[model samples]
Target: MIRPPALRPGSRVALVAAAGPLPPGGVERAMDRVRAFGWEPVAGRFCRGRCSGYLAGTDDERAADLDAALADPGLDAIWFLRGGYGTMRILDRIGWPALAAHPKALIGFSDNTAVHLAAQRAGVVSFHGPHPHTAEFPDFARDTFLPVLTEPRPAGVLPFPAGSAGRAEALVEGQAEGPLLGGNLSLVASTLGTPFAIQPRGAILFMEEVGEHVYRLDRLLSHLKLAGVLDAVAGIAIGAFSEVPDEGSDGRPTVRELLQDRLGGLGVPIAFGFPFGHVDDNWTLPMGVRARLDAGAGTLELLEPAVAERG
Candidate 1:
């Protein structure tokens, strides 16, 4: 993957809302965080614009904001404001060629997974981390986020979240190395059969999701398995599946059981309850970078830096 240039303290970063609109004061809060990191924060014209209820703005407007960010020569990175629900609507509309010609680190998770996949397809590495609009940026997240983007060195070993000893399990124990791929499970599953569908072959797939019912989660996993994605990966790092409910009425297995049933026999290292999702302690992950997953050790280690050294 093509790593973008490492960010400097005074680098200009553009904040754009590519999915849902930010809540009141969300943009201001994000700008403050950027300043705290010693970077200049620039907002896209339509980042705060709302239209058709949930979308940040009209599809064209939102796409334009992203395009402008990509085309700006002075901006060192583009930080997505928040990820709610509209990125898929404009995935193809954004100028991928322009972005590839002038690469910059694109950062966010959830709906921004669409953008990350698009970046991967364009041969650019992107960051899967907490959005700038997060209500509170935990210290772990900020520490992880800064170094990955600013330092031209490996991110070191990332262990499974603390307190996960009760929930973390090794389904397929062993170590596997491959480029890191995948994001929100629902977003990854949604791209099936499309040009943006995750290329999981030879990848250490990482996944997380929120608010999904257990059966629906099973169905999504089933879809991936049937599509040959499950069999193609080198290993799996399962992140948090927050708020997943047991409908109990259907007599279906719980989410954890379904996960084991679907992925246990894949013949690759599998570590569950990784700490990168819609939670307080989310860690930043570099998409498309080669990584090593050790299920026995409950650790994921990036093999290379996510950014290029400043020239």
Candidate 2:
């Protein structure tokens, strides 16, 4: 994938709330974080506007705001404020041709997976990382966010904070080098048969989720299997699956077991638990950049500089 222009310090970045309403005190924290990164944060008008029960604004309003941000030549990036349930609502409304012509870094996770897939379709790389609302204002956000976004090269050997565990625990120990793809399993699976289905062949596929029952996770995996998504990857990495209740040794397969059962036979490198997902310390990963996944070493290293600096 072609990298968009790198966002330099003091660049103007737009903060958009394309999903749920911005929670109380959320935007302030994100703004502070953005300032810390040395970027001027231009909050979207819709970011603070509330419409229905959960959305930030009307579907048209959200889509239009995003369109304006993309079309603005001065905007260096479009960082999503938060993700809940509104992006799909404005998918078709996006002016794809315009976005393709004037690409910018569009970052977020969870509900923002739709936009990531859309960016891929538009032939631009999108960020699958924390949002300003959740990631910007927090301390761990600085540890992961700043390096990945501001540095000239993709950070090497993503390090998890102390006490945090990734999903794959020594499963299929090996290494993989390829572009990074995949996001929340449910979101990726939800795109099946849709035009935005994940295309992860020969790429390092990373996945994580939150608040999902083991059965639901299994079903999503089944969907990927049925759609042949699992068979087309070069390597696999599983992030933290949070909020899953303990099954109490009922003999039901855990999420990791299920992953191994489905992906192990592929003969590719597989590792779990990389300190990513819907959690604090969510490291920012560029979706289309080449990377090496060393399961034996428990590290995912970016193989190339994601952005080029023009002196």
Candidate 3:
């Protein structure tokens, strides 16, 4: 995959609402953050527009905004304003040929997974990080974003804070290194049986989800297994399953137990609860880049810089 140039102070970033519409005052909030990061913010036409209860605008508007942002040679990056559930509708309208010819960082996650798939298919690395509107957009997300997006170097160790458990836990031990891949589980599941399905051979697969019960999570994981998605990766890093029920869940195994049963046996090192997810402390992870997975030690180390310097 092609590494996008690292963002610099003078770089311009376009804010586009490619999926769900921006919430009240969301555009301004995101713009403030963008400027705070020392990058200029360029708002797309749909940045302040809205459509139905969910989408940012009509698929046409979203597609036009994305295409225009890509064609803008002056823009160094395109930060998706928010992600709801409409990115898939405009996949065909994206004008990928243009984006492929002029690659740049397209940052987001959740519904933005569709765009990340497109970037991968086009051979450009995309970021599976926080959206501007998500609470995860600031602290935890910025730690990864600031370094990689500006003064990038090989991030040798990725760490998560110790929780009430008071100590870091390791689900699987030892280390397995490979390129990072995967995103929201539901989005990944949506790609199954589709043309854009993620193919993560020799990859350290990372995934997270929110608002789903154990049964549904099991179903999605099962689909991945059935689709041979799990078998293609070298290791797995499962993040926080937010709002999920605790163990003793309707006579079924808990989310952690369910994961242990399905992903644990992939014959790969697996680690659970390493921060990044639908939460306030999500880290920015670069997709399609090599990283070392020390599952037993509770760490994922990036082996190389995620962005390249441009002359």
Q: Which candidate leads in lDDT?
A: 1
The RMSD of every model to the true structure, in order and in angstroms, is 1.6, 2.2, 1.9
- Model 1, position 180, has a per-residue lDDT of 97
Each prediction's Cα lDDT score? 0.90, 0.80, 0.82
Most accurate candidate by TM-score: 1
Reference-based TM-score of each model: 0.96, 0.92, 0.94
lDDT of 2: 0.80
lDDT of 2 by residue, 223-287 (tens): 88888887888888888788887532577777778777777887888888887788777878888
Question: Model 2, which residues run further than 4 Å from truth?
Answer: 135-140, 163-168, 246-251
Could you give candidate 3's per-residue lDDT for residues 97-162 as a string of tens digits? 666677789999888888888888888888888877543355656786788767567877875643
Question: Per-residue alpha-carbon lDDT of model 1 for 1-311, expressed as tens digits?
Answer: 78999999899999999999889999999999999999999999999999988999999999999999999888999999998999999998988987788889999999999999999999999999999977799777777788899999998887444455633568778999999999998899998888898999999999999998887898899999999999999999998888876644478776667788999988989988788888888889999999999888778899999999877
> In candidate 1, residue 214 scores what lDDT?
83
Tell me model 3's lDDT, rounded to 2 decimals: 0.82
**TM-score for candidate 3:** 0.94
